[model samples]
Target chain A: EKASQLQTQRDSLSQKLQETELRNTELECQLLDLEQRLENRRLESESFRKSLRSLLELLDGKIFQLTELRDSLAKLMESDSS
Target chain B: EKASQLQTQRDSLSQKLQETELRNTELECQLLDLEQRLENRRLESESFRKSLRSLLELLDGKIFQLTELRDSLAKLMESDSS
Candidate 1:
């Protein structure tokens, strides 16, 4: 009777081991998927940063151009008034 | 003698064909590279547009806040004067 109980305990332990291994494999796969997603996000962020830099530069150029245009307009207005 | 001349002509034609093929391949590669660069530029432009939109919204909000603050200060000054 004790031998049967011991056998049953061993069977349960083996079943638990298999379940644990399966869970570990599932977790590992999930981890890899998450890592891949993170890598993609990093690349996307890098590209976004580069685009932002370019846009800022473009905006600065436009602002400078607008300021020059405004100054020219002001001068023209002053001359007209004079 | 005529056969020898024909053979020489054929060889020249074959060499020209190979050169043309190589040129075509090079042009194809350049075209692909340009297309990829254009795609990257387009994506960059899209992100830049989004960022600019957000920035404009933020600037508008701040401007509205500043206007409100100025109006409140003006009212306070008027009351003090009275």
Candidate 2:
């Protein structure tokens, strides 16, 4: 009867061990998936930053061109009066 | 002399015509530049819209992933007790 009890206890311990390993695997997979998603988000954010920078440059160029045109117009008007 | 006065008037008229042509050319150049800039701004705005769409998709995906994780965790806990 004691031997039977020991065998039953051993079986229960092995089953618990297997359950813990399976849980660990599931948690690891979840963690890996989360990491991949986070990396993708980071890359996307970086690309957005680059695009914003380009947009700012374009705006600055447009503003400069507008200012140049205004100055040229002013010069033409002055020449007309002279 | 009357001929001298006529000659002076002709020179003034020709000078005015040249000035008008030059002004027209300058205005045309400015208009073309403005149009090009406007086109560039439109294209940039479209690109920004696309980026915004992509960002929204990324946010939606992340939210979905988080919801899935929450559900999985809840299921895991429920199973553990059972």
> Highest TM-score: which candidate?
1
lDDT (tens digit, per residue) of candidate 1 on A8-62: 5555555655555565556556555655655675688789779878988997897
The residue-level lDDT of candidate 1 at B26 comes to 60
State each model's C-alpha RMSD to the native: 24.0, 47.1
Tens digit of lDDT per residue, candidate 1, span B21-81? Answer: 5655565565556556556766876887788799989978977996897799689878995
TM-score per model over all chains:
0.48, 0.47
Docking class of 1: incorrect
Supply fnat for every model shown.
Answer: 0.00, 0.00
- Candidate 1 RMSD computed on C-alpha atoms after optimal superposition onto the true structure: 24.0
Structure candidate 2, residue pairs in collision? none
Error of 1 at B39 (Å): 29
Summarize candidate 2's per-residue lDDT along B24-69 as a digit string, tens digits: 5565565556556556656875897898789779868977996897
Candidate 1: list runs displaced more than 4 Å.
A79-82, B1-82
Lowest lDDT 10-residue stretch of candidate 1 chain B: B1-10
lDDT tens digits by residue: candidate 2, A8-79: 555555565555556555655655565565566558768978987897798689779968977996898789
Instruction: Please tell me the TM-score of chain A for candidate 2.
Output: 0.83
